[model samples]
Target: MSDLVSVAAIKDLLTECPICIEHFDDATRIPRRMPCCVQSICQPCLESYSGGAATLSCPMCRRRHNLPGGVKSLPKETVILKTLDYLKIQKGLHLPCTDCPDKEIAVAQCDNCGTFLCSICLSAHKRNTVSKTHTINTFDEMKGRPLQSFRRLHQCSQHQQPVQFYCYTCDKVVCVSCTVVDHKEGKGHNVVSVNEAHQGKAKSINDVLGKIEEKTKRLSETESALQKKIENIKLSMKVARDDINKIFDNLKDRLNQRRTILLSDVEGKSAENLKVTEEALDSTRLLLTKVKSSSEYMRQMRNKADKVEDLQVMGSSKASLNSMLKESPQEIPFDRTGVSFVQANVQHLQNTINVAGMVRSVTFSPTERPNGIPDTAVHNVITLEPAEFPTD
Candidate 1:
């Protein structure tokens, strides 16, 4: 019995949902199905295997099964299926028609089962019967090709025929039929042959192209100059960073040396003050003990009465002791003046590149006569001798 129980436990551990074949984490709430004759499967995989059909057939039992309908029976599942249907529609997933290879049949999907059906087969599905009036666009319309405009110079918009002439005054293309109709109607329009108008427009377009090419050359030169200026700015920044770093290193070393000297001076002054205070405290303690002993001696000699003279000596000793106790200890004033270094205010030099100034005057005059011949005929000639300046 124990061996059989162990075997069953091992089998349970290895069991997988037939749909996913990955271990099942839980069976409740999460879409899990126990087939009528087979093991369990996740609901999603089962639905996918059934081709989103209204009726599902179990692979194990070979028995057909109908899915639940309406929001009341399966609200959550129906919502999920409808979402999938919406995505499928957006993706334009179409199945080719079996009857006609070229023609594709549009499917009307059921929101509940995610089932897609052609117009003919949709009549058989009870759930899809209500969706008969749903709008559907054909495959051709879904492609959405741009509309072709008949606005050419020699093309007619009305009859889509070749126009023989251009009505320059009206700026319209017209055929012989339109000229007779439009001209007879007293439209007061000017007309020219299509060939003549085309030639005139061609020459104008070629001249504009030539001007554009010339401007493009100037633009290329300007772009090259701008790029060179940017490179110069980058190089200047690199040099500035390097120079500033060197200055900071030098300043830091000088400050550190000053700090060390100041710290040593402060320590020496503090130690001297501490030693003097200790010596003063020891002297005060010795004086206090001597005075305490003298009081006992004065009491012992009171019978002799000659001790009254010694009272004057004790008074002088008391005065000396009081003076010593009242003395102030000398404190060394610490010098903190040279402890820190003041940083110099370093200013960055502004680098600039001024473009060359323009020429003040550029006079353009013809060097040749009106007949396109060089003007070599001199009108007047002047001969000058040496001139002298007056000496002061």
Candidate 2:
């Protein structure tokens, strides 16, 4: 037993339940299967979230399933049960006492009783008086232990004898007395040694290990790919953010240029209009002074001169005043225009903003995407150009 119980063998036997993180065994690692996902879920986890009004969701896929019949109705995963059994047998390789619940490792196996015993139990068994001829072998004696002999140590419940022969037809091990009775040769029973039967079980376990290894390799590859994908997505997001920011920055510069141009035009037009109005006012003042002088002269000279002299001065004043009045009408001339924003014809912007004027739709995909939408659906396109605005 000491030779069989190597460091590697003990390491291989110490496995934990995926859900509970306890030793994977018949008691704790009870497996249940979801009908929709068909994947094994540990019973402890199932019970924790089962039978509530909320539907139980698959931990792997997150797809919800109804357990109308409750948690007990979930199907048992037979494969997982077999897996646990294989693990239990591997554990027994490091022989443990049969009678105690404390998991004390046994030092020897009783050949006559077919049971592994601890130091205390072995001494007690040797002292017992049922004709103490029982042969005992220490773990050090069995340097090359046979793997199949572990399960052969159990006694048959009916005969109280060590189980030795495995009945192929019944698919179970039986005592010598059972061979004569229930497992009779007349019934064509193919009873073989415990070694052969257990060897077959070992082969089956190896097959399961092979499949698990294959899946583990695939899972590792997928994990690597997913991580790379996430990194690439983050890079893409950063690039898009920087590019969009740059585009918007340029748009702001163009807007500033437009504003400057519009304001300069208004200033130039106002300055030109101011000059025209000042010249018109100056011409009217000069004409008004001349008219006053002509009228005063006519009044002062009326008493001393004849009608011809007064009429000549009045005619010249009338001509000058008429010219000034004609020029005044032109000052009220109105053809000045003001500037405002106009809507662009771009469809995306037109659909969004109410006002229309150079509606620069900087089209971009969402930085934070909604669930279920793939990265392939994302797109970013920006266009900038000035559009004519309707004036009020």
> Poorest 10 consecutive residues of model 1 by lDDT?
352-361
lDDT of each: 0.36, 0.47
What is the RMSD of candidate 2? Answer: 42.8
Clash pairs, candidate 1, are: none
Off by over 4 Å in 2: 1-18, 21-111, 114-131, 137-152, 168-170, 177-190, 253-392
Q: Pick the candidate with the highest TM-score.
A: 2
In terms of TM-score, how similar is model 2 to the real structure? 0.37
lDDT of 1 by residue, 1-392 (tens): 11111112212222334335554332322323322321234455566656776666654333466766411122122111222233334567654332233444646543333234466655545445665554433333433322111011123557655576666565555777777777433677777766666556445433433443443344344334434433433343344334434444454443444334423433443344334433443333333222222222222222121221122222223333343334333322221111111122323212111110111111122233456444675322222222222122
Residue-wise C-alpha lDDT for candidate 2, range 35-123, written one tens digit per residue: 43223456677667554544686553344768777665775544344334334444445556874676587877677765767888888
Q: After superposition, how far is residue 219 of candidate 2 from its true place, in Å?
A: 3.4
